[model samples]
Target: MPKQNSIAITGAGIAGLSLAIRLRQTGHSVQIFEARPREASGEGAFLTLAPNGINALRALGLAERVSSLGIPTTGIEILNAAGRRLALLDEREAQRQAGAASITLRRADLLEALRQTASAQGVDIRYDHALIDIERKADGVTLRFGNGESAHAHWLAGCDGVWSRTRRLALPASPEPLYTGLTGTGGFLDCPHVPSSGGVLRLMFGESAFFGYIKAQEGPVFWFDSFTLDEETAIGRPDPAALAARTRAQHAGDAAPVRDIAAAVTSVPRAYPVFDMGHLPRWFDDRVVLLGDAAHAVSPHAGQGASMAIEDAVVLAACLTAYGAPSRAFRAYETLRRDRVEHIVRISRRRGAKKQAKGPVALFLRDLLLPLLLPFDAKTTQAVQRYRADLDPLVLPAA
Candidate 1:
């Protein structure tokens, strides 16, 4: 049997936990370090995992488990500010092609599932051990923690998020995450007046902002709003009540449903400023490499951030299994992922730009062009949704 590799993964997120699970399945010794406490680490809003992401989870024998916890999204309904339907992107055909339906669920649920699975698979996860420094040595890499502790491992994977400490310590020259000038706020509401769409995502392109909602079979309506802001106006965080008021005001004049949904938000809405990292020149240094959001933080407009991270975990593990040597496997992993992730990032940026459309002319052009352009958008969705990581044996013999 081949000698098992000792890998230290920074971040117990979807990427890190999934990577740990896959590595352990392949007989690797893996440990995870997370900055936040285990209980607090799972705090996040809901997200949609496309079919491609589902397929990646399937590789880990987790698709069925995740699907059970999420609502299966069948299609998307695009609407104008006046509640007029613009275009419908049906997922029936895409699901047929992809062999799975896209799913939307709370980010916390998915993280919890990954964490439990990782633990069951014998991954040693330590929370509240934020990585503070990384040093490459002759024999291995040393990881320093903020808790006045340190450890060494033969290989290190930076599955930490956008503001990754590993990325900073390992590749200081890498580009930082750029603020996209769009702020997102969302919350759940039980508005009986708002009819359920039976798992279809309803999205509206308003004059000054964007609104989206979907209904689970039994839960409250899931809704989100995004709008552009000037750098100067995007100062300190707004409290939940203030954010709710701002969101309601932004979409108040758009449509009845928009107003109704905004008013229906009973709980204080949480806010997040959107950010993304563009193409990175490199994703690794020696035995240390970056994964998922640490390597490419895609804008949320494309709704593939988590999916991309899941795909990265599967591909990275397969590469490591094929190559044995950390450097070679990391290079192959980057080669397989960079182009795909970069393309998604570009598409997300374009989508975000359209969502942040301002001025009468831009809004007019968007309303006019969206219907004609939706067919192409559907085609792109097919391509993205049908992606499958090729985890077959590499042509090169294993080292």
Candidate 2:
């Protein structure tokens, strides 16, 4: 009876796409609805897939295939405004401690990989179906899309991203994402003078902002910067040029690479306010359950958002298969994931606070204290990367 029910997923991003594949593998009829057009993804951002992220995708048999999307990343080199190295968080050590290498690639590339995998697996994904409303029934849910289409499913998984309409509709009391008062933007560049970064990613604590860059041997140098943003400035979601200018001004005197990259990147990537929603008491109601950023949006400071969602997909699918119903499975999933995800959210918030550090005293204290804390932070990250979303056995509740 459990496998007999139809499953519907909202959002065709990593979370929904992965979940759809998992649910299909579990013998569930799954359909995914994505509000945006198929081409509306990738957004000029790049990401690093940590070992744990690779491990999570491995559970879905996707690790090896997606490896083609990015280059291997060996370590993170942390530096100050003066280009003085603070610490190099060695990924080799992390790999020894965890079990996989990190991959650095464009956010678009990863999505394309997942999208291809999902499609190849015969997952039913419908694009341009933006969810507008959902009607909850005892046995299932009726979803209304902006395209004037309505569909019903025995179970609904809301894998919609940070601005999830499903969360708002399904759980009215869920708090809005809390703005961390930080806005970030980044771009890619190909400069002849800039050498290949190989497996190293550079992170700089600049005088007025935070910057990071990852180079793909002879390819483009992907860079990003985050700085403090007041409510007024962040409201309009500053244009790319303005963001670029601001970033250039902030990092002009930091380091040669930072300055060079800033000067070369003419595209002022959109500087959107970074927000995290970590106050939800529950992630589901009856047949409707939230997943990924829809449930708990984590700041990019942790770099675990995608991994966490991928883990959630695998675990939740197992729970559903084990418990044979939505309520119990969702509750178990929540019980298993809430603390971990919320903790990551808190960590990301704190890490982001460091990027917004202002004043000479604050910068001095941060630079002074970060080295002492680097080892511990690296250890914690390695441990986090080793986490496997293994599920214990579950029995259906008695009728």
State each model's C-alpha RMSD to the native: 3.1, 3.4
- What candidate 1 gets wrong by more than 4 Å, as runs, is 1-4, 231-235, 266-269, 390-399
Q: What range of 10 consecutive residues in model 1 has the weakest lDDT sum?
A: 390-399
Q: Go through the candidates in order and give each one's C-alpha lDDT.
A: 0.85, 0.82
- Predicted candidate 1: what Cα RMSD to the true structure? 3.1
Pairs clashing in candidate 1?
A: none
- Winning candidate number (lDDT): 1
Model 2 ranges with Cα > 4 A deviation:
1-3, 390-399
lDDT accuracy of residue 359 in candidate 2:
88
Q: For candidate 2, what is the TM-score?
A: 0.94
